[model samples]
Target chain A: MRSRADVVVIGGGIVGLSTAYHLAKLGADVVVLEKGYVGSGSTFRCASGIRAQFTDEANVKLMKYSVKRWKELSDELGYDVGFVQTGYLFLATTEDEADVFRRTVKLHRRLGLGTRIIDMDEAREIVPILNTEPFILGQWNPEDGKASPFKSTFAFLMRAREMGVEVHEYTPVTAILVENGEVMGVKAGDRTIKADAVLNATNAWAPLVNEMAGLDRELIPIKPFKHQLVKTEPIKPGLVNPLVSPPSWNDSYIIQDAEDGGVIGGAGVEHGPTYDVTPTYDFLREVVRWMTRIAPPLKYVHIIRQWAGFYAKTPDSNPVMGEIKYVNGLYIAAGFSGHGFMMAPGVSEAMADLIMKGRTKVPLDWEWYDPHRFERGELRTSAFQIG
Target chain B: MQMRAPKGVMVLGQTDGEDPRENIIICRCNEVTQKDVEDLIDRGITDIEEIKRLLRIGMGPCQGRTCIPLVMGIIARKTGRRMEDIKVPATRVPIRPVPAGVLVGELDEE
Candidate 1:
């Protein structure tokens, strides 16, 4: 890239580009290095589900803030992100899950989220295609919605570039140069761009980037696990309103993509700590079974595309944000556990505040996501994470 | 050198037919023409995975079954790299569209 810049962001996905946009807005010269094209990482494989429903107060607050930003992101980016406010419906299969969901709903409402524990009838009404048999209880939040990944991410990338940010596609950050525990520059491709600040936005590749800066032990529990999402061919739209999910956390998510008429969702797996992002036949079968049950109409809609991408999962299935304790001028906005695509705006803005000032407007204890949390066994887990 | 066989019919730079197939639609599922793929290659998307994502070439209903050979041939010729060296992304299973009944059977195994 350029011989010098104020900050070098490693990764051109939504998180990286959003951080670049926020950093540029803060009057910092930024260069983004992406080995692949923008929106081609975990972003491309997203089902585009956005929700404010979480069991933990930190996540609930973070998602509430994220939802507020997403509602107005279209206007800010000057492009239609296809932000269809289809709401989010969580189906609880067992009595225990129903009890947990009810408690979670109360907590969410107290946190200023319009979440409620609803009956199966309401769930079916929201998404008429839902079978409503296996679900004993459902949680509905009309404020949550979905957005198009490619369009929204490209919007951030374009806006960042327009704001004097240098984004180099096909230029991967090979190494992060640190001197005296302070940031220096990054070796991207062949050129070394000097940076007083460096952001490790490389979610799945966090280990590799941190190792370059001699901070490998900080994120020892972070690993990239493959998740597969499938899409059906253009079906008649409006069949499903809210994104639907089964109680079996990972294996159940079904929502409509407003941009294209295809209904998109995923088949979740438990085995991980592997970087293999290969789509398996197993996922297709599981997805079909779980999704069709939630929305029976999916049985007829033929799947058009199947793809897999990485989820940079931390040990607690939550994100690791903020700066490394030992490295000055080095910040982390990685390990989002597949929620990165939906929460990019909030995370990016918070990271920008953390880098520019020592604090963030995000009211939650953003420091809880510190990379060193694992070493101290101070991990905070989010109870609900729909793959 | 991973000696993987070409996945589809090589048609990008093939000169066998009298009418130039260069302008023809190779990925019928996604309506990706030869020119569309070549332009992506010109922009340095020589890798098959990038070409699929950017141009939507091999990401359609038929997957890459109809377009891989045409793309691989063009990439090899353009980049001066041997076919073995050209890395194509993984070809996932469920190659044929399975009926709902077969899918249920797979779920039952779990």
Candidate 2:
């Protein structure tokens, strides 16, 4: 049996759903296919950290637009996205690190991002528990915040559906029906969805879809790494903002979820030789060690719960967007490197523009983030790629 | 200790009818009930693997970190097997949750 639609979007993650949502808003007949329940994949497990801190102007611009959309999400979607503007604090413990932060903040200021390089004293005022003893400088962006990935994606999906997007969950894309060197549609189970355009929005599983569509391309080698999040029992004192140690000491950050009265936090623990999202005793130990070092009051707090999520990696540690070279009627928007949840809205908008109107104001035309950049032998490294 | 019987198997010490113990939840994320587990067991899902496959009890984001031990205990009590006799689910590598940012950074470095 076969079904047809104007567009068939594979993968129901935030990126896929957001793309479907935008396409629907553009008055296109769209259908979303998913192998699992909504937000159950990488989206559900996301840390939900949204930040505008980026080394690339394109990423900064996209994330800035995302932040704008996030600000209006509650009104736009008619649901609370749990978007809290607690801000992002990037601490630097060394002079070299401070220099890098200074340069980034200057660029951010030029873009009117309102980020500043503050001293230990100002950083202390924002997050009182920060271990200023080890850090001399910090990059403080008062606008960066966190939100619930589930709620945000749900909002988008709901609003998108209201705008006439059809979504099918637990429907796996068995194959891509391509002919004459172009994508015809997608086949899910025994159902074939015919469409003039196809989008490969599956994040970690992007390479498989690319191969299925016969695109001579692969995602940015997004290796799935696991990290654990531990939540402490309710305490009296509350944290005001997110805290991140110097990139050298910790490759991750922690945030306080006052909604549940628990200090929910995690770090980018070292990855092993494989892609597995299992928990370990060593992770629990390191989490306690670091949490204690950062927030002394948390040392004695009993850990009530813990869970793991896979971090998808890209080669440049930035999201890969825009059209692929060889495959027509096919677009690629994967390899977010763990920043996809927050960047979904703006990224999807840009992708929708490129798909519908052929050009976008979202500045995604960087040669570094080019879809075939690796094949073209061009790689630009960005320094602000923190977990 | 709360002597509530494991969700579905009815291991000798459970409250009567309808409401099971709120604290005794199977698959913390999905909240699969004790009755849910017992139904799965009665339907020939006595083994942990089969139970997980049928009920999706311990296959959530936690990946059986907390629920597996309890599931093993339940299976032990019901099948007259030791807790050690019940095998733990397979543990894979990258044995911690990671942010996508760090994962990508590591890949870029490689």
Candidate 3:
């Protein structure tokens, strides 16, 4: 069986669904294909941490717009993305680190962001259990918060459908159809999908999809890195806001879920040779050590469950966005390195605008994130290096 | 976690201070066997990848959520497989199970 659509999205993740939703709003016939359940990829396993405290101006602007969209997503999608305004508290345990925080805060404030640097005492007041003895200053942004990645992705899927987007879950793309060195569509199972435009938003599996399309693409610089986060058994809430560790170490950040009392925390773990998402004892031990060091209250709290997720990393640790140069009708929106969940809303919306209206109004510089940047020796370094 | 041992499978681990011969298993996700794992190397399924394929040690719905560590310990018992050889599997999203029906319901097909 052969099908035709105005646009065929290669993956049914949050980014793909959001793009479909926006494209359909512009009256385009969109079809989304999924290899697994919707939100089952990186979307469901995401930490769902949204913030505008980024060091890079482009990232800060992307997040700033995304935070706004998130605030009203419930009304837009008719389902809560679980946007909590609990705020993000990034602490600086040393004076030199404090200087960095101050510089970041200045940039943030200059951009009209409500981020401010506060003393350790103020930091302790925000998150009561934070041990300020090791910190001299902190960055506070009351607008930053965590959300339910599952619910958000699901909401986008539902809303996209309501806007007339077709989604096929468990339907893997067996191959991408290209003719005369241009993408024509995709082949899923025995069915051939003829598409006018194809968007690849497969996240960690972008490389595989690109290969299936037979494009001479070198996403060769992109690889997967494993990261693990755990939730402790429900206990008395020790912290009111998210606590980002001083200088971003293995125990990068920990925050209490506002909807569920479970504490959500992340630890940095290295990638193995093969694609392995299994949890590790090393991560558990290091996370515990840092968690206890920063917040003594977590020492006795037993971990209830832990899961690992892969951050699709590029050579520069930044996303590879924009259209592929050789693939005439193919667009690339993958490689978000651990920050996909937060960046999806804005990136997807931007891609949708660029595809439908031929331009994007968002502050995102599509040129900087071009898929051909690596070949041209251009790389954008990510500011946040920790988990 | 309570695990009923599958047929022809021997229970492994501390046994929670209970009888080791009882019909109870350590990892519940994949019905792996202590004896099956022990015989893995002799059966030519020596490495972690081979063990994972032979006995379904790390291929369950949880994707070795509870059992990978146990399998790692069993592999660690053998001095041949280095500590670094027991690397963790790649973590995909939707950590917990979600209804496939919900995903299907999201699409607006003709």
Candidate number with greatest DockQ: 1
- Which 10 residues in a row give candidate 2 chain A its minimum summed lDDT? A215-224
Local distance difference test, candidate 3 = 0.73
Ranked candidates (TM-score, high to low): 1, 3, 2
Write model 1 residue lDDT over A315-376, tens digit each, in one string: 88888888887889988888888889878888888888888877888764666667778888
Across A1-387, the per-residue lDDT of candidate 2 in tens digits comes to 337777788888889998898888778888988786666567867666788888778778778888988898889778668887778888887888889989999889888798998888988788777677878788989898888775677777778778878888778888898788788898887777898788888877777778787654343455566666766655554464564556666665567763445566676675742456667767766666666666665655556556676656666666677777676788888877778888888888888877888887765554556667666655667526554
lDDT minimum window of 10 residues, candidate 1 chain A = A215-224
Chain B TM-score, structure 2: 0.67
* DockQ ranking, high to low: 1, 2, 3
lDDT of 2: 0.71
List ranges where model 1 is wrong by over 4 Å.
A218-220, B1-58, B64-93, B106-110
DockQ for candidate 1 = 0.16
Per-candidate RMSD vs. true structure? 7.1, 8.8, 13.6
| Cα deviation of A163, candidate 1, in Å | 1.2
Indicate the residue-level lDDT of A327 in model 3: 74
The most accurate candidate by TM-score is 1
Q: Which 10 residues in a row give candidate 1 chain B its minimum summed lDDT?
A: B101-110
